[model samples]
Target: MVDTPAPGTVRPGGRTARVRETVLRTAGDLLAQGGFEALDLAEIARRAGVGKTTVYRRWGTPGTLAADLLDDMATQSVPRADTGSIEEDLRANAHLVVKTLTEPRQGRLFKALIAASLCDEQAAEALHRFYATRIEEWAGCVTDAVQRGELPDGTDAQRVIAAVSAPLYYTLLNTGDPLTEADADRAAKAALAAARAGTWSTAAPRGRPTPNCDN
Candidate 1:
């Protein structure tokens, strides 16, 4: 009963797309303003000017609505950078995270979504998928670096990319520290250093051909 269309099934500029956009927009606004506890399907339908029955039929629960929102967010997320330098690419990734986390509306929206994931299994799975998508997208930076001989051949691209964001999330969720551009730069630099030191390199026991870092 998810509102999101199946892959390759959504038509551009159609009524279904319009309905989804309106409903998701209203849902995001509600989450940002009042958090997950305040997201009501009936209110979303009313605010979006869509039929309650349509909302109820397509997205049966708050968790499904939140999961759908996360799906949309992942689909619309920014593409990774290709600056020909691993440092620059990682910095770009880190800065983008900081920008999203520092923006008032987006910051609150993400917090609300994280809260929803903490309490709802459906939302949690969607949240995990969202991060996985983002990480996989950015992992290209590391793989490209490896191809260009900028990183060790066995470096784990996804792990390196995750390293760039882990500290930022820790600050956001635990440290109560204000995230700044400096923090982003430092994070990227630390990840780059660790990557260069082969911290994420996969070890091949004894004599097996080393697996491709891009794998």
Candidate 2:
């Protein structure tokens, strides 16, 4: 539970919000610098120049703090890019995933988060939600395609969106291979082909309109 001021006790307001932001930022910096093991809540309070009691009162544990930080990140995360065409939208999605993976701070941050979540259920759940939100955001592209008649009715937008990024993430995390634009292109093309082939249709998979990818 969050700390509450007693009667006649000063309650947190604007200044408190700013202090919380500062503490979270400080914690994020520490997390980015090192993984979960490197996180130090007391140190974060010290760096933020806030009382340790205040920090503890706001967030009870490293996991809670991390979860809250991830929540904030989700709120500020990149919105899905709409390019008005399925191909363009998929390409943009691929590029965005690549860009995020290759970014200096974000890449390592995610890596650490993923590593930390292995042993922490709350962190794991939070991470799962973050990806789910991202996937749903990207799914809009496929939904738009279906509405535009680029795809047939009843396409699995979620699976299609996941297909585009799943392999990229796999290669990045599981293998030593670097995530490149070429990889993104391959995934996009493959997903597009599969979608065209009705590989992800909701109805009987036997027959559907064949997509012409020569465009």
Candidate 3:
């Protein structure tokens, strides 16, 4: 006779993980299908075969849901590309960021989040944190290049990260132009040129001794 184990105790945590994944995937699908307005928590619960109480209990409000969704999106983000040079890394980062901003439903979602952040302080903080994480992640690539002598010593990593995105966002929001590969390349080249010119290196601490700092 074959032995059969009891149910419910073997994979309880796994079941909960699957449920959460289902909810997140459903929310992503709704966002992809229609913009922010289409993301009804009740509808999402129904679609995901979960309970409305569960959704509301977990996320609370629409703004909270949006903020959490962006957090998840950031978690799913691709790591910075390493191509042995700041130029290549910045170019790749710019292109990927542009791609995210120009995507169909994601574009609308960003606009919605930006508007919400303008009105709500918590939302603004969440958005700020999301961008900060991405910036820091990309900045690590530039810092690595600087350490390798590909760039001047003491280059500001955060500024290099910001330089890659600033013009792209400006063109995207103000100029109303689609960001192309050429535009990404231009931004990368300009930032790399400025960084190599020692614009960012000048801000380094003058005559500071290394206090046993290790990589």
Candidate 4:
């Protein structure tokens, strides 16, 4: 007798993965074209050539599907830059963010995801997880800089990393300003300056140290 795989344990590159890829691609295409409201499971199954039941069973709802897509994106995101100098690493990170947000399809997809997150609790959680993953990946750069004495001791690595991308995101979301390579460089430089100036330090306050309570 042939053995059947467990319900949720399909091997990588197997039939399940292929189905998932097709459905996600179709979903992404629809999202880029018409945002979150355009996501319909029946239409997704039709476009992906998968069974409607399969799509529904796997993803359940539009919000859940969007959350799954974000999870996939986080998994597939590029690793952080590890250049010797923190400035170079941060510049690379800023440039990458600009490149992603400026790409036509990806930009639209991101906008749709952000919109979905605004209206859907599940999508919001997934969006938060996505950023957390990306931030943790890049935090290594700050830690390395601190170890090399380029940044002061007690620097908050995640804060420094967040600083690098904050302005770029603001440009993308808040202002209608075009994100240029120069802007990317300037963001990285500004974050590096602040980090070097101890803006993100986690050290004790300047006034005094805590008194030892144990007697």
Candidate 5:
């Protein structure tokens, strides 16, 4: 008898992965075109040339599907830059964010995901996970800088990383302003300055993991 994998499990590659890739690509296309409300399972299956039952069986709800997509994106994202200089690394991170948010398809897809997250707990959780993954990856830059004495000891790496991305997201979500290289540079500079000024210090040595900034 053939074995069957559990639902939502990631396969290295095969027909299962092919179907998933097709469905997710189609779902992302629909989302970019019409936002969260457009993520109909039957439509996704149709566009992806997969069976509606297969799509439904794999991912029952739009929220869950969106969450899965976000998880996939997190895994697929580029690793943080290790440029040996905190300023350069932060600037690279900021520029990468600007590149993503300004790219036509990616920007619309993100807005759709954000809309889904606003109304769906699963999507929200996945979105949080996505950012946390990104922040954790970038936090190493700050920690390395601290070790190199470029940043003060006890600087909160995650907080400094989040600060680098925060203002860029604000411009995307709030001001609706065009993001330029200048904006990216400024965000990196401000966060680096803050790190130098002990703005995100934990008041303790860097032996333990710093407390999460959400508190």
Candidate 6:
């Protein structure tokens, strides 16, 4: 199981909200400028104008701090597109991902956070939740497509949405090649094809129960 962030991590409103905004922004700036290695609680507190004791007591470690930053980012994601066509919607989602991955500050910050997730359990859980949040936001388009008869009944919306961006993420992480609009378009088309092919609609075979590996 994943550990939760500590108290005073990110309050919802009022003056505490403003303080969190400033602190998260400062932390993001530092993370983008340098990487996970540069996340110092005292420095973040000084730069963000918050108390060092508050930062240390709230986050306790760099991994927890990075996790909180990721959580904040997940909450700030843009709403998904509803273009009346699954084709357009998936493409839009893909393009939006590419845009976020290619933008200077956000791109570097995302890369840094991904690196942090690889080595830190807290960061990994937060990152997983972050992606889950974004994927759920975009899954609506798939559900709408099914309702409109554009896709098969009982289609797995979240899986389809995840398929659309999986290859793009692979390209971003595995290859040094610059992500382009063409790449986004291709990924969107491929996922759409697979969805239409019942790749995500098939149910388990008769009497073939799913094996439980958690024992």
Q: Largest TM-score belongs to which candidate?
A: 5
Residue pairs with backbone atoms closer than 3 Å in model 6 (clashes): none
| Candidate 6 lDDT score relative to the true structure | 0.90
lDDT of 5 by residue, 101-188 (tens): 9999999999999999999998999999999999999899999998999988889899998998899999999999999999999999
Candidate number with the higher TM-score (2 or 3): 2
Clashing pairs in 5: none
Q: Candidate 3: minimum summed lDDT over ten consecutive residues — where? A: 4-13
- Tens-place lDDT per residue, model 1, 3-83, is 976432343678988898898999999999999999999999999999999888878899999999999999999999999
- Per-residue CA lDDT of model 4 for 26-75, tens digit only, reads 99999999999999999999999999999887777899889888888998
- Residue-wise C-alpha lDDT for candidate 3, range 1-215, written one tens digit per residue: 97753211122458676876787677767766675577788999999999999777766666666666667667778899999877789889989978888888677667666666776665577788888889988988888998898788889899988998899888877899887888888998899999888888955554777567575
Backbone clashes under 3 angstroms, per model: 0, 0, 0, 0, 0, 0
CA RMSD of each candidate after superposition? 5.4, 6.9, 8.3, 4.1, 5.9, 5.9
Estimate the TM-score for candidate 5.
0.90
Candidate lDDT scores, in order, read: 0.92, 0.81, 0.78, 0.90, 0.91, 0.90
TM-score of each: 0.89, 0.85, 0.79, 0.89, 0.90, 0.89
TM-score for candidate 6, please give it.
0.89
Give the number of the best model, judged by lDDT. 1
Model 6 CA deviation exceeding 4 Å by range:
1-5, 8-12, 203-215
**Candidate 3 root-mean-square deviation in Å:** 8.3
Question: Which 10 successive residues of model 4 have the least lDDT summed?
Answer: 4-13
lDDT of 6 by residue, 1-215 (tens): 98874754647789777877888899899999999999898999999999988787777888988898999999889999999999999999999999999999999899899999999999999999999999999999999998998887778999999998899888888987899999999999999999887788854533567989997
Clash number for candidate 6: 0
Error of 2 at 202 (Å): 0.7
Say which prediction, candidate 2 or candidate 4, comes out ahead on TM-score. Answer: 4
